[model samples]
Target chain A: MVGIEPRVTSYLDYATGGFTTQYAAMLVAAGVCDTVACVFGANPRQATVGDSGAYVYDPTYGLVNAGAIAALGWTRYMSKYETVEEDLGAVAVTFRRHARLNPNSAFTEPLTLDDYLATPYTVWPFRELDICKVTAGGAALIITAADRAGDHPKAPVYIGAAGRQQAPLELAGDEHLMCYAMTSVAEQVYREAGIGPGDVDLLMATDSSTAAVIHTLENYGFCEPGGGGRFVREGGIALDGEIPMNPDGGQLSGGYLLGWLHQVEAVRQLRGECGERQVAGARIAQYATTGRWRTDFLSTIYVAE
Target chain B: MPDSVDIRANEANEAFEAFVGDHELRVQQCDGCGRRRLPPSWICPHCLAEEYEWIAASGTGVIHSFIWYLRPLDPAFLATPYNVTIVELAEGPRLISKVVGVQPGDLSVGQAVEAAFEDGPPGATTLVFRVRETADGAEG
Candidate 1:
C-alpha cells in the first residue's frame, strides 16, 4: 500500500508487503529506484472500537481471527489438555527476556514463563503477554544503489532472494491452518537465495503473537508442522538455542511497528552493530513479516556483503 | 429470540438477523451450485452467483474452535473470561458466536452444540450457541 503526502518534503510512503522494508530494499538494489526509505508508526494502545465484542487490538479482524487461532490450535496442533498457555506462554517470555537486553524496547521488564501464564486472557488463546504491547512509535530504514552505497558509513548488507507468499485469505477457508502460509514462503526464499533454511545463521519470523512464532517455526520447516509446540517448549527458538530467532526482542517485547522495526533489528545485526544481541559471526539470516496474519506478505534472506 | 435485534450492518445481514430474531439459524445457499456459506457475502464465492436462498441452518454442529477471554479490561466484552467460539454449522459454514446455555469453561473442542439467540448491547441481537450434547452425556 503506497500513500502519498503533498507538502514541502512531498515524499510518498511506499509500504509494501510484510517485512515490507526488504521489498523496498530489493527494489532499490534492482534499479527499481535510486534509493528507498522504509518507516512505520503505530499506536494500537489507543485505537478504540465501539462497545461491542470487537477488540481494541483490531476492531474489525482481531475478534474473528482470535477465534480462528483458537480453532486452529484445537484442530491442528494441540490436544484438549494442552491450552495456548502451554506452548505460547514460554515463547512470549523468551521474547521478553530478549527485550530486557534491548534498552530501547517498550517491554524491558523480565517476564518469567510462570508470570506470563498467570496473566488473564485479553483474548482467548492469547493472554495479554501473548500479544505485543500497544506501542506508539515509528522506525525507518534507507536503501540505496550499490554504487552510491560507498557514501554510507557501514558495510552494505546485501539482499539475497527475498520471497513473499500467501495462503487463502478467505475467512475460515484455509486448509491446514498451521502450515498454510509460511511453508510456501520458505520454498520461494530458498529457491531465490540459492540457499535453504539450514544455511541461515539467524532467524526472525512474525511475532504478532506467540502463536505466530510457533506457526513460523513449523511452517518455515525448522521443525515439522505439528512439532512447533515441542520445538518451542524445548527452547528451540531461544537466543542460545539452535536457531536464534528475534534475538533483538520480537514485536512482542520490542514493540509493534507492524513488524517493520524487525528490519531495523535485522539490519543492525547484519552490520554487527548489535553489541549484545548479535548472533556470533552471523553472515546469513532470514526474516519474515506479515501485514496481517489473515493473508500474504514478504520474507527476506539477507547476507553480509 | 430477543425483542431487541435491530442492528444489521447490511441489507443482506439484516435479513439473516431477522431469522435469528425468531431463534432460527440461517445461511446463504448458492442459487447456481447449491453451496452454502456464512458471514453473508451476498454472492456465492463458489460459482459467482449473485442469487442465493436463505435457508434455516440445522443449528447443530460441533465446536470447531473456542477461546476464553479471562477479563473485561476491554469495553468491547462484558464477561469475565468470556467464551468466544467458532461453530462449524452442520450445513458446512462456520459461525463466530458464543455460548448461550453452556458453561463457558466446560466448553471443549469437538463437542456437539446447537444455536440460540439473545440480545447483545440493547438494540442488537446476536446468534449464539449452546452445548447440545457431549461425548460423556447430554447437555443443553
Candidate 2:
C-alpha cells in the first residue's frame, strides 16, 4: 500500500556519503520526518582516470585518491614511527580474509601478506590491493523514528549516537599531519553513547585506502597514535581479535559504495545476521569515515534493539 | 588571467597568487594583532580583525610532509614519480607545492627549504621550493 502522503523534504551531498546518512538519521531523531532513505552510489568506471571531482586543484592535481592517502599514511606511519611499508599489508590481508567469508563482497579471492606485497605500487606506499576497487554500484539504508522502529519485520539497529568534527581548513593547523580532529570526534561519539572503545564489538572504518583503516584505528582510541601499523601487523583488528574491524571487508573488498556498505555491515552485525563473517554476539558496532586529507571526520554507533 | 589557469583559489587565493606571479611570496598580516595568514584573507582568522595588509614573506620554511606519485594522475604531470609537498612557512602557515632539485627519497619532515619561482605558460607563475643548503654545501 502507498503511504497516505509523501514528499521529498531534503537532499544533499558530501565528499563522504556516511555524513549524509547521519544527517537523514538526525532528521528522524528530531521529529522532522517519520522515515528517511539514504542512498549512495558511485560510477568511477564511466569517468576518466583522474576525474573523481574531488582532486582537481593546482597543488592537488597529480595526487589522486591513492597517492593523496598514501602520502598521509607515509607521513603518519613511515615518517613518525619508522614503520616499514610491508607492515601495511596486514590491513589488506585481514580485510580480504573477511571478504572471503562475505558473500556480498566483490573481491573474495584469498590474500596473504606475501600476495598483497607481490602487487605493484599504485602509489609509493600503496599497492593496487591497498586501494578500494572503483566499481559501479549502489547501497542504501532506511532510518525511522524510534517509535516506529519495532514495526519493521526484521530486528532494528538503533543509532546510539553520531558525531562529526571538521578541521578549520585543509592543512591549516599544526596537527593536520596527525589528523587531531578525529580524536575529539571519537571522544564525543563514545561519551554520548555511554561506551568506550573497549565496549565496541566491531568497527567498520571507511577503507578507501588502507591508510584510512590505520587512521581510524588510531584516531578512534583503538590504539595509540603512530601505533596503528604495529596494531594491524599483530592481528589486533582481525575478526577474532579485540576489535574486529571491517568484518564485511569494508570498501577494500566489499566494493566502495561510498561507505554505504559499511553501514549495512554494522546493522547486520548488530542484528546477528551475518552468518560467517559476523562478530559473534555483537551488540555495539561503530562506523567511521573521514574526508580527503582528514578535512572532516564522522562516526556513528549502532546497537541492536 | 588566462582561461587555462586551473587553480582552486577563490578571490582571496587569487590575490595571494598575484604576488607570486610577480615573484613575491606574501601573506595577509592583520593590522591589529600582526598575525599572518596564507592564501590571503580580508579578515584575520586569529584575531577576527577586519584590518589586514599584504606583507612579504621570508620565503623560507620547513618541510611538514611530502609524497611521491609513482604514477601520474593528471595528464599535465606526465612525468612519473613526481613529488607533492607541504611546507610550513617560517611565518606560521603551510603551503602546498613541489620540491625541485632533489630526489624523491631525499626529503624528510623538518628539513629546511627556500622558495623558488617557475614562470608558467603566460600569466601563470607558481612557487616551487628547493632545499636550503648550508655554507658547507650540505642539506640544512
Candidate number of the best DockQ: 2
lDDT of 1: 0.68
Candidate 1 docking classification: acceptable
Task: Evaluate all candidate structures by whole-model CA lDDT and list the values in order.
Answer: 0.68, 0.77
Model 1 chain A lDDT-worst window of ten: A47-56
**Fnat of all models, as shown:** 0.44, 0.42
**A26-129: candidate 1 lDDT, tens digit per residue:** 57767667777665675554532211112343332124433335334434345423434578877887888888888778777778877877787666556666
RMSD (Å) of each candidate, 1 decimal: 5.8, 3.7
Taking chain A of model 1 alone, its TM-score versus the true chain A equals 0.82
What TM-score does model 2 achieve against the real structure?
A: 0.91
* Residue B53 of model 2, lDDT score: 78
